[model samples]
Target: MRKKLPLGVSLFAMLLLLSSQAFAAPQSELWPTWDNSNESNSATFDHSQWQHLLDRYLTEEGQHTLFNYGAVSSQDKAVLEQYLTDLTSLDPRNYRQSEQFAYWVNLYNALTVKVILDEYPIKSITKLGGFLSFGPWDDKATTVAGQSLTLNDIEHRILRPIWNDSRIHYAVNCASLGCPNLAKTAFTAENTESLLDAAATQFTNSEKGASVDGNTLTLSSIYEWYGVDFGDNEQAILKQIDVYRDGKPLKGWSGKIQYDYDWSLNKP
Candidate 1:
């Protein structure tokens, strides 16, 4: 009646399918509700709690910043939960654009950490998803201003679309080794610009972000996944990268361009 493929062939096919899904990025489409911001509003949002969590748990190991997911105590976890609750309770629409940017970035990162800690001792963040899901990104992580928002919603729908800044790719950390380093300090309206530039520079120079070999230019899957955010073509992408790259700039590369990402947990 039906024929089955060999075990080896089936395994290979499955791996290929998983790989394809892993690199798939969502498009940046605006959610009009989040587009409202008050330039005249001079209010400030507090993020010291998030910074405290980061200072205690996040550390630099080699070029990557690893979070101590396993070592976080129950008390600290409760504190984290409180911080997230306080963040989502407010309406960001009434805040200034600068403050709103910091709020979303901090919220996105905190929610990601909470997700991992809720189910620690895992090898990769990708494993948190369901049978057909690649990650917990699409799952409703938090409710902001009575609007249920997922990690994808905060990133793709809000931050990317509202700000329309390519540097945002460096701001939102995904709690993975391949993702950009989570900032050591919490972002504030005053520090967001500097933090964004610092992250871009650090990631562009690191091996996990971009590397060149003889004739080949290999990059993190982030560039390929969100290529449109980073200029949408090889030359344009390289140009944007060069702006942050420290050493000799990457010039013409007529050879193959490759992209790879590590889904492993960013933890010590």
Candidate 2:
């Protein structure tokens, strides 16, 4: 006959296990975790880990499987599966927004990349005959965090809602040639505020972005694309830039220039 365990002993063992897990802080410093340089809030990033993550998820041809719309090749899907496995262990609270934002943004973008990679060589994202055929991409299909998250969900639901700041437009790389370059490293929560500020300043400083050279200000099309993101009016938008920018006086000139969007999907 088998002996029954005492209730008290079983309870004690369970409590011990739970307590140890509670005490074990998640590993914050590990593969693919962002570490802030902590120098200037403006320049706080350590990309060594992020670069590795990018190499792992992004295909050798500089593409991804999931975010690929309908063109995900078998090779791409294999890599994406590996990435998802690694990501399952991630705990966002372990790092700062700068650190985690990159993770989330990249995750979103990578997933989209995988979608497109599945149907590699497609002329457009809409050829697959789903909500993608419609204008609003948010209707497209995806699942994250047990919720059906569309591309719009990542941008509108998770990213915009959490940050509540427009400057993110500059930092959250959309994997489009027109989108800002993906930061070489991930942004850390500790550095998020400063990083966002820097992104605004960097874009405004660029003559290509928004600047005046002898009364001729050649501005990037980003301003035109999401004008409402800045403010109701163009001048209002420029005023915000004025608050952050230095060097050549911006108070004097204001006018229109050509609008441009980089059409090439951001590839290696």
Candidate 3:
């Protein structure tokens, strides 16, 4: 004969098993580090030049309005290209973690702008890909550290995986209105921490970040797609959002969460 446990006992045992399983899971690695200074004694890599260009072109709104593509001058284009070349030449392994973070972010943003310039006059970035694809994020757009790399490589493989910070979602602009504002000032090693925190705060306060209406909570598809990057579950994501929620965060927000994304080019 067989004996059955009480329903309460079965539930308690199940929860205990689940709890142990969760505790056994390995934690993600902390940010990568290098045994070198945060400075470049070789060549001064100031992104202030890029900041100047961004200031000249970007208009402040919830979305940073980029000027008409055709209006971009040859001189500006040359400067951007030179910056990319200089950045690619540097060995990030020689820089401090903060410097490396800034370098990668700047490289990603600059490359994104270059992609838009190379294929200008498009309605959406998604249209600039193969007939069956939406965009060219996977294409090897440049070489770094003697290896060819793509936009996906910089974002997914390196930045997101290595750093494991969700604030990055607010730093890398995809040239779309749905993305976080393309910062007016360039990211510098000196200002990386403050800038990252500011970016997170700004995005969460914006409508594109999180919107609540009664019982429904709407979030950007960025949160949904990259949920793991944010945290373990919805509550974790909400906790991150609450940290930067503007005005008043919704109370007792045990509501359904939905996602939306706009792929339109963020042009003036």
Candidate 4:
């Protein structure tokens, strides 16, 4: 004979079941590694030229920053092209862990900017084509260490898998207003940790990041999509966001979660 549960107990059990399903483990496997352990120190990569260009083109506002994509001069563009060439020419596996981390991050951002420049006056990054007319993420954008790779490769295969840090999402911008604001300076090996923390903090605190109202919580689609990277469940995800939120209220944030994103070019 089966004993029927009480109504309140049944409702509580149902809620728990829904919660478990809602925050299921991420489908993708995350394997963290630092490719070059034999190297003691990171090689100094010259990003001053890139820094100079960013200073001239990146405009900062109260909460977010924008890039003056239309203002990049041909001479400046040449410098960027040369930078990418130099980066691609190097053997990434030869660099130290810190160096390689910064290298991949900078390479990804530089390439994103280049793609946007190549298709400037366009509405959004999705306009760029990938396999089957998707975004340019899967397009073979560059070669590194004698291997042809795409933006998706640099991010998902290399950075995300190697570092296993959810912060990588904030570091690599998609040249969209919905993405994290592009840092005004180049990410150097020395400054990489601090810069990453700053980026996460900034993004989590922004209106585009998340907001709590009454019993409802609204968050970026990023959290919804990459929720596993942040935490095992919504509670864990909210806790991670609070870490970078610097004393912001995430506790008692229950009920519903909403997501929003903007795909427009982040231009000034």
Number of the top candidate by TM-score? 1
Residue pairs with backbone overlap in model 4 = none
Candidate 3 matches the true fold with a TM-score of 0.81
- In order, candidate lDDTs are 0.90, 0.53, 0.76, 0.82
Mind giving the per-residue lDDT tens digits that candidate 3 earns over 90-196?
Answer: 77767766777788898898898889999898888877755444577767778876878777777776777677788988998888888887777788878888888
Off by over 4 Å in 2: 1-50, 53-79, 85-103, 122-136, 139-141, 211-218, 243-246
Q: Cα deviation in Å at residue 70, candidate 2?
A: 16
- The candidate, 1 or 2, that scores higher on TM-score is 1
Q: Global CA lDDT of candidate 2, please?
A: 0.53
Where does model 3 exceed 4 Å of error?
1-44, 62-68
Alpha-carbon error at 149 in model 1, in Å? 0.5
lDDT of 4: 0.82
Q: What tens-digit string does per-residue lDDT give for candidate 2 at 97-138?
A: 555576666566455555556556654443443531421244
- TM-score pick, better of 3 and 4: 4
Please report how far candidate 2 places residue 170 from its true position, in Å: 0.9
User: Model 4 TM-score?
Assistant: 0.85
What TM-score does each of the candidates earn? 0.93, 0.58, 0.81, 0.85
